[model samples]
Target: MRIFISSLISGFEQQRAAARRAVTALRHEAVMAEDFGAQPNSPQIACLRGLRESDMVVLILGEGYGFVPPGSTLSATHQEYREARETKPVLAFLQEGISPGPEQAAFIAEVQAWEGGLFRGTFRQPDDLQDGVTRALHDVTLANATGPVDERDMMTRALAMFAPENRNQVVPTMLELVVVGGPNQRILRPAEMEAPQLVEHLEQTALYGESRMFDRSLGVISGLDGSDLLLRQERGASIRLTEQGSIVVRLPLDEPRSARGFDPMSGMVLVEETVKERISIALAYVAAVLDRIDRTQRLTHLAIALRVAGADHRGWRTRAQHAANTNSIQMGHGGVQARDPINLLARRAALGLDRSALIEDLLVPLRRQYPTAN
Candidate 1:
């Protein structure tokens, strides 16, 4: 995430620097007016250009309204924010002690009213502003990766709910059942095998206990069903993917292309170009979450777990390296530990059968937000 820091260079310089460090600490690029040397264009033009390029904007309001470029009604800071809010999301922080001038206060009020812009509390210490920016960035990253309406987020939330010891079994089973054909295939679809037969197949593969697979598969079904990504044939006799599910699989909607080499009914395979594209997009989203592991360790852990499953399916080497760098998850023996961090965290949180609290904490909010999710 390239975060544009918009503020007056005079009074709020320290706060701006703090925000820059905070954003850099999270591994995101920070764009500030100070970083760019004197520009030939009007200062307003230069600032607005940077804001336009930014993924998100962070506005800091202090005692002064700052400069008003010739021929412009609003000050440079307010003008940059006004233009940025029109396109990108904005995060505004007002200083605590300094009373803004009338124009600045009015601009603050207008910013608070902007749709999609977030207004946070006033800041006194530089650390306060830093913390505010950090939290806001985390929320934005998480929301982008796993918001209520996001399909991948819904899938990840579901995967996090299963007991840690069983994730290896559960995730592979879900992937195999949902995705058909190709080198990365895991297991057969539910419709192809009866409950008894499915259990037998699991035993043959030595992947999971029949009973556990049965229980976990139901959970997967419920989550996907609620997300409208999966559908069961009359009376639950068989299961099939919804159109959204097809999208997950990277199956093309164009009839001729979809039918050319693969079975349209077979759904998305790892081989498709669309799957590659989705993996790329998903990696970018996961990167932001991974960057903030310091404050959001558990949620970041869950996010990596979800990504590892998808990465393994797609054979994404670069994605694996990125996760490993953050200590979120890894490859080889380290990878096993990465995937099963849930059980260890659970054990540390509590004893005996009550150890799922860690997972619950991360998932409960998502469940509430998406009440329809099982």
Candidate 2:
């Protein structure tokens, strides 16, 4: 497999070379920015292109945050790492026994917080990093040899939990999120979903200190097909826990009475803040459920999907636009969906670390569907 090596060039020349040697020794192609002698595009573009081409990424974090180019908020190394985490497998190595600068330290913390797509280690010298990389790559290869889980199939199963007639009659202008554990993860039994602790965790966890996502007053917790658990709300919001270890949350987004002044028949208007809050709540609930089922902090492969349905002729509005009473930009699409498999830490604390970035990643495709403003 081809691997991309990403790091700051000035401070970690030795480490980069060590990583390259390790990759070559394993008979893998190591792609680095230094090897690109001359390219028509800028260095950032070239580095990202190399990263996109590679199957895996080896990220080395040092004391410096590297150079932040003009018109970019993040350093090149930071950008590369972000890009790699979204798609390719990443093996991250942090330089130990040294104090990183404020920005670099924050970046390191952010990376450590990410619950998905990471194989992390620490090293004091180039040799240690090289050995770690070799071992990590071997582990990843073996894991891949088992074959990847079918994310589309998992999504289909999750969606099937909601009956077609019920979905059409009850859930309109809804945000549906599903998280399914991969084959390697533990398969939750029907009894586990009925555990008192799990139900309490779902009802008690507050989304914003006071507002809870699941309340007994608004919903009823019941059994489904003798194997799955369902929490159906009166207001069209619901949560389904399947024996196959999938958590599906459906929240209605359209309330014509609440969002007055707009013609409800035209389409739904999605507020940025409202959408963010709902996604955050759904993820928090998923994390809580995972924690309740299995206490292990080990990485678990998971397939996650987010879908916005009944979105034909929909519109999206930012907070600023809403305050100014400006019109929302038309989505020009029927529905939006995003699905990807990830290796996650499966803990609430770990999910909190990169939750915003994860949410943004899921929203990117939907955002792109909106027409450009004049």
Candidate 3:
């Protein structure tokens, strides 16, 4: 992957260097101003070209907004970010405790206010930036590998591919293989997979076959393992899923049936009301699930971070909508505006429920109302 590193040229030279080294260590190319050489073209043109060429952008912001290019409104760095957003994934890192000029502050505020799933965080030092980037890279990889699936299908498919002979032992053996693994921890133990089935499958895939279905399936499941759906941990020479893994496992999701706008036999359009009803129920289910998740969840935290920029007297539902827009978080079915779980959390906080207590004291009761979900 080619990663474009964007930041002000001054005051961030070392940080840029660190980022380049970090990207190189990951065996990915880093595209930056230094790579452009003494091009006859303007720096702004060069920067925009690099941004467009890259697969992802790592935006590092500090006190300076950098120089504005001739005939352009935004500073070069800001312009690059805005342009990159149209095509490439952006991972923004803000230097902590920097007092920016009013213009720079406004740009940073806009970034903070964005309603998309662009990853952003604060860093105090070069090392902090490197660590944050590393984590972001892992998240990007997982997201690219597989779009979200309900947990049951994720696990069932994992077992069928990894331990095919022991497919009946899906949940228990998966608990033994991946549930205990967390980020960067031991993720799988083929030996502990009940019959060495997983190891043999990989060995056979590598030795034969034009396309390795086992590898493809393992890639998606392992991506889930990295995403905290299966908490990875080192357990005495093996790895296993943590307790949270059990809570997430559910009855296998039914495959969605293909639907058409018009019925062939009747030569009539399907009832819009029926489609709307199905969507409504799904929205309710989502609301119930979100209501159970604690405030510490990333979506909730992102919403709170927006408060610092200004909540604009918006209602919680509106705020959540804006957050979903800004952060690429899925909100709900259209026309099904159930109460947002994050809003409930903010209200509970206002009522003097401690942040730590909100999940168990408030959210858990809501979860019990939807017991099957819990």
Candidate 4:
């Protein structure tokens, strides 16, 4: 992949060299203004053209905002960044411990504010810049290799694996989360899945502690069918990891239960605090799982879907009410009830840097379904 390195060329010569070396080390072509000699078009025009042709942009910001050419309000680097952000992924790095000028500070703030496609990092030295750039480029390379996926179908099949035999049985309300990652070539070998270390790692990272998806038990059912690794709890929760790097976790949510017959008061109460905590724990576990797998196999991207089942009659309440009692807050007549699943696509970098943003992105729509309480 061709990566465009954008920054002020005057005082940032060493840093730019470092970034170029890092990009070339990964076997990716580095497009820099320094490399472009006499061109038919002006310098700014040539720089913009080069940035447009690149697959990704590595934006290095220092204390200076660089030269703003004639007939243009923005600097050359700024122009490249504006154009790159529209179409390509931008990996931004800011120099640490140095105060920036007003314009440069504003530019940095603007870049940081756009968290969707931008991944931000900080470096104190040339070597630090090189290392950060190399790692970022590697991640982008892996993301590019992850082919297209049918996320809806993937979620459907994953849910089927944990479906109950007796359809009439009233099961507890559950939150089913599915994450699919891969290069679409290979993920985990069957032998690797059964390794004692891998099982131990999963138990420690995902299945243990108070926030665990399943109950603490010695009975862990591990099986291999074709190219998938299946782990299940005796209760109801189950986890399926595919050779193509897909993970499906089905676990029950904490909700008020009906003792005997149909109780109108007994319905799904999604407390705001509890919902946020659970989602955070689940995301952290998934991130740990991916990191563990990344040691052996590279992952491109993650397709994450969060589905809440049996929530037809649901109530949204605050943490204070939930603490008082599960049934403290009665069913509300208002609030948009959501039956559809929440699907999200995240690059590998976003999982680490923009986790809070990811949580908000997933929960914002879900939260809107509930009305504000008095």
- Which candidate leads the pack in TM-score? 4
Taking the tens digit of each residue's C-alpha lDDT, what string does model 1 give over 1-374?
Answer: 88999988886778999999889988999998888888998667787888888899988888888878788798888788778865676778888877777998888777665521133556889999999888878776754553233335434443444333343442321221121111111123444333454324333222132212122233222224443323222212122322221112111211223434544322122222322333333223222212221222212112222222322222212323332442232122224323321111121102111223433443333222211200
Model 3: worst 10 consecutive residues (lDDT sum): 302-311
Of 1 and 3, the candidate ranking higher by TM-score:
3
lDDT per residue (tens digit) for residues 224-331 in model 3: 243232212221111222222211221111112347433221111112222222223222222222223321222221011000011111112222233244333222
Q: TM-score of the candidate numbered 4? A: 0.65
Off by over 4 Å in 3: 115-117, 147-374
- Deviation in Å, model 3, residue 98 alpha carbon: 1.2
* RMSD per model, one decimal: 19.8, 9.3, 19.4, 6.5
| Candidate 3: C-alpha lDDT | 0.46
Model 4, span 292-352: residue lDDT tens: 7764226646667776665545677676765456444544453434455677777665775
Q: Predicted candidate 4: what Cα RMSD to the true structure? A: 6.5
Give all candidates' CA lDDT scores. Answer: 0.46, 0.69, 0.46, 0.72
Residue 192 CA error for candidate 1 (Å)? 35
Query: Could you give the candidate ranking by lDDT, starting with the highest?
Result: 4, 2, 1, 3
Runs in model 1 lying further than 4 Å from the true structure: 115-119, 147-374
Which is the winner by TM-score between candidate 1 and candidate 4? 4
